[model samples]
Target: MPHADTLTVVHHDDTRTSYTDVRYQLHRDGIRIWSDEGEHALTDILMTHAYRQREARAS
Candidate 1:
């Protein structure tokens, strides 16, 4: 896990029928979470949700 510090979550979202992506993402590992699906898998989810929330607050 080289440069793991730089390997941040980047973003998260709650796309499931339950809790938000942020809550779910941080549930197990907090920030440095891993999935067999790959890096972008979770990061993309968080990224979308983060942007959505940002826009919502702006409006």
Candidate 2:
């Protein structure tokens, strides 16, 4: 699992992307995900652990 403060990136399209925060609900009904663009259901957010990666930094 990602750390609470970690920023998540979602690809909305081939040329569009969104950064979001994903958290579990207090009641455990489901997860909550949101970004500057908007919010969406956990089920609506498609992701894969195998595809996740850390951002590279320049020296």
Question: In terms of TM-score, which candidate is strongest?
Answer: 2
lDDT: worst 10-residue window of model 1: 50-59
Q: Across residues 1-59, which tens digit of lDDT does each residue of candidate 1 receive? A: 21221132333454432123222233333333433433333324343122123222211
Count backbone overlaps in model 2. 0
Report the lDDT tens digits of candidate 2 across residue range 1-59: 23223444333342323343433232233345444556545433333222224553432
TM-score of each prediction? 0.16, 0.28
Whole-model lDDT values for every prediction: 0.30, 0.37
